[model samples]
Target chain A: MDEVLLRAVVPTVIGVLVRRGAPFAAAEDAVQDALVEAVRTWSAHPPRDPQGWLVTVAWRRYLDAVRAEDSRRRREERVEAEPAPAPAGHRDDTLQLYFLCAHPSLTPASAVALTLRAVGGLSTRQIARAYLVPEATMAQRISRAKRTVAGVRFDQPGDVRTVLRVLYLVFNEGYSGDVDLAAEAIRLARQLAARVDDPEAAGLLALMLLHHARRAARTRPDRVLVPLAEQDRGRWDTAQIAEGVGILQAALARDRLGEYQAQAAIAALHADARTVEETDWVQVVEWYDELVRLTDSPVARLNRAVALGEADGPRAGLAALAQLDPALPRHAAVAAHLHERDGDLATAARLYAEAARAASTVPERDHLTRQAARLHAALRA
Target chain B: MAKYLLLKHYRGAPAPVNDVPMDRWTPDEIDAHMRYMRDFAARLEASGEYVDGQALAPEGTFVRYDGEGRPPVTDGPFPETKDLIAGWMVIDVDSYDRAVELAGELSAAPGAGGAPIHEWLELRPVLAEQRTATE
Candidate 1:
């Protein structure tokens, strides 16, 4: 049995049950149980229509659960009528699941977990391992999120932006587990993009694809970070970049500009360059200006400064950087880069050392430390 | 998520509020402290914050390589002036603030007279091996 195909139907089956009056939490649990059974029995007796089979098995499981739990007796009465196991319609309620899982009431962390479980079709254990949290802790977080949205109507329109943010969090967060969360986030984003008419959903999918295209070039064999400018351009997946840029262009043509689109535009520009010197820094700076105006985020402004340095000169970048708070993360690193470009070895070395001290991840700290050491050695020579 | 090491010093840290030596404490008080510690670990595990906790033996030795031909250089089970850690707990939490909150809770483990120890625990972040995609 194809596991991906099996997992893909999970949200659809759950959506069917929820629409039929089962609680979201119970429906989700039942679908998980049905999925386990499918793994066990599908080889012997493969279902002709996978989604239909899943809906039937999952619905039965839901009824059994409702019967077993004393508190669900009233809900059990409501769903007692068993409709014939006809093939589930192509009507996609998975979109509703996306909105429910990313409900605004849930904390950002909780929202991410719920989205991974409910829409991404990942198990609690998988999510816990991905997040480096205990299974019990992750389970509680997911259940709490489910409870928070338990009362929400299945058809109530969800905030598309909230769903996109949750998906983005899943994509960007680091995880060293069996599951590739970046891939999972892309899968969910793709599904959302298809179901929703919003251009931002497409934009988010485009952004994820663009970033994912460079996964191989992002690190060294021993897992050291390779900064974008230094990464081997040949290592990028051209096919993925083509797809991302294509989608981005379509979304941009709609003229519904969003931060994700702006970010993807920057990523596409980087991908377009074969060498560091060939990068269209002028266009990158323009995109950053759009991003800064759209979000007014300090980090965006900080990044725009780096592009400005490349487009104009190191002095111009430093002048722009000087306006921002020095305490912002990576501020020292950016300052070091611009100073080094300005031919100020001493200042660059000092800032590199400071950046290394402030680095959060081991690889980044090592990379910055090496940069500092290299500058220091050159000064000595 | 971030991992933090909560270090409990045996001798180096400034005295806690309930500063009486463990040996000087009544047997019941000792039991209470131990019980409190056990419960704390259990609670953290249930909440999914706990990674590991361990108590270290007070006696330790220092060793270093002498040369390619020699066995090694050895030093004393260091004196009281030398900082010795009593124990350590590793926790994976969501934020620095949460780590601080948990460390504060751990410091409140019962001590002599069954009062909060209020010990100073050194909290240090464990450098993450994986870099986030956005970074």
Candidate 2:
């Protein structure tokens, strides 16, 4: 009956099956079957040891599938040569599962799908609903992903960066249908942080926590985006912000800075402020500098320009913005803000209109359009 | 039930009755227009008639393969006179009449002076999969 408890143990159960000589693909499918059965009967006959019960049922399912295949291929010896029982020490193979699901050979979409299923323990139906895709399409994607990583060996440590990237993608998917992907990302990140010694893992967890803490104030009920400066600070989750800042402080002390840590640090600063005017723009600008140096991503630089506008003056922000390609995403929006700050309402209105035209999402376009409309009204006044 | 596409255009469609450009509309008028559009979509979703809705950016390039090992040739971001698709909504309705009624409602979204835009929307039926005929 405890869905969270069920999902949390999924990867671990899958890991246990893999160690017991089941092929990775077959083990994942078998675990999914076990999960369905658990949902059906677990409430009426709750197992005293959920993990043990899942492993037993999943292993049996795996054996039945192999036996069916054996009969077809006439390879009875393979089924007979089952490996020795794995040690019952409860070694967490969840981290290895993350690496396999996020295998470099798979496409990003495939990796994300596989990770959500094999590592996050989400059902294909749930995943499909979250993504607004047909359940059959999601199943095909997960199947393809499993096949792609079937040959992958988990003997070596996975690039923590790859796993982090996959988790980040999941987080950005936000919420839809029955699943809150952001919360799921946070849960997976917490699990990964517990197993890995990487500060970046902790940093990623902190970053998700900080961003998620502001979810309530990020939009209006009508789905219009509320700008960061305009968001109701009282709506921000104080406890989550505190947790994020504490994790970020610990990561910063390690002195091995990464992009996620730097991003988290910026988020921590924003959360630190009680109001827009109280925000430490100087520190925010500094973090943006670190972010740009670490990633050299245009997005970071564009954001840095906004911070600079607030920290120094609108001129400084506009000057920084001038260096980047005008074609960059959100470039026009940034330019509009800087121009508006510089008292050039005409230019700001024009840029806002352009930004609205180019916006990729409905909410973003609506937000930008409103901005342009506001400025145009002011100009007419 | 059959699926139909209700298409809106940035250009190439006949000029609407309320022909004022969106940028020229008052802020309140613009907000009203957006609200009308959202409410329409929400109603369709509530009735289980909505499949999908999306708005596209005005700019798009036309690209085609040039030759083996050569970069694809590309054309202009289309001119204003060209028939540019603004966006579309896909709906599964019980009949063609229902699709037309929904499209009509959508085209009546508020525009300048809080009046209906009465914009032209092209309603097209989506071809369904071939059916297996029963004996």
Candidate 3:
């Protein structure tokens, strides 16, 4: 049936449950149980009003458990607190679900798991497989997270920063199993951007969109690494690139420039070019300068060096790189590229081999090894 | 936390400080070494760090498609291809240091004279499903 629509409305149903004076943890559990049953039976007999159906089922599920434990008086109190079933199209109720999932009391891992479960409407099995964790471990983490935020008010104020961070974590983890976590993250971020006027939320959405655009060209069919300089620009998702840039431009116009906005600006510069040679490296390097100023992260500084090389010269890039620690991941590979461009093939080859030894991933190591082999073959020729 | 592969080569890697080939080692030493490796992997499993451990036969042939309708061309397993990988242990740990610690323990499996092998185990990080470098 309509799975996406069901997930989108799940938060609203959960909000209704929480608003009914159900414990946050119990309400969430009941909503998930209802969702599972909906998936199994909906194909046989789809409901005319999915949201209303979900609400009735989940609310009843919540009541059934609480009824077994409570006396008539306490049951009446909860029943009195239950809000009348209204149109589930209200965005604020869903927004509160996002906040509750990203509650500050939970660890980032727990927050990400909870957000995917509660806001993204993902089952524990799907979430566990997506993250490569055991199902039992994921279950414990989600239950623990639910318990941690059980005391949180349904309308409690939430930090947008924590919410953004949790979403970023989901986006960065990529995707596996039945859940496309990157797409899920983008969906959740889009929802977050719509509800909050926070520019950073839009900025994060833009960043995810822009980065996701180039995903196809990032690897070969056999899974070999494709360097950015060589990626086929035609393969990029032009529609997503345009949407991301437009959103980023609007967010930048808000004048509350955030880290995500700065990052998106650099990504947009890369997306704007028709070819690698046409890329606006000067602007990218400038944005990196701003990024280094804002965050002072070593990773940003390292990337800025590569952009510096394109904008200026390889020697200039090496000079910028010299200021940073060589122990940084990918440092040797960057150095090797710069040296190769500077026409020092021997040093480049050595560094490439060294970098391969330290490479974190199989494809990266293979790529670096090929670089070294290519240089050696050139010398022999 | 990231997962790493501790790759041990049958050959091609630099010789260990002990310089004792497993074939040349005494039978008791060989048994002890094998037991040590097995126990190390089991201990890792108990600690929830071991994802997998696999040993290759070192006898696989290279094969490739010849044409649209033809059978695949199988090439010789050349003796000159000296960089032969023996096996690897995949470990999930909280830090690179922990992966290294486990790799170190694996390298210290007994050699001749019942001494540590001091072998080289290449530690490589397993990248996630997509391009993380895209930022």
Per-candidate DockQ vs. reference: 0.44, 0.02, 0.13
Q: Which residue pairs clash in candidate 2?
A: none
User: Model 3: how far is A240 from its true place, Å?
Assistant: 0.7
Docking class of 1: acceptable
Measured over the true interface residues after superposition, the C-alpha RMSD of each candidate is: 2.4, 18.0, 4.3
Residue-level lDDT of model 2, residues B112-133, one tens digit each, is: 9999999999998764321100
State the fnat of candidate 2 relative to the true structure. 0.00
Range of the 10 consecutive residues with the lowest summed lDDT in candidate 2 chain A: A75-84
| TM-score for predicted model 1 compared with the true structure | 0.91
lDDT of 3 by residue, A332-354 (tens): 99999999999999999999999
Query: How many residue pairs in model 1 have overlapping backbones?
Result: 0
Q: Candidate 1: which stretches are off by over 4 Å?
A: A71-90, B63-75, B80-82
**Best first by TM-score, ranked:** 1, 3, 2
Write out the backbone clash pairs for model 3. A360-B125
lDDT by residue for model 1 (A319-351), tens: 999999999989999999999999999999999
Docking class of 3: incorrect
What TM-score does each model's chain B reach against the true chain B? 0.94, 0.93, 0.93
Better model by lDDT: candidate 1 vs candidate 2 = 1
| Interface C-alpha root-mean-square deviation of candidate 2 | 18.0
- Compare candidates 1 and 3 on TM-score and give the better one: 1
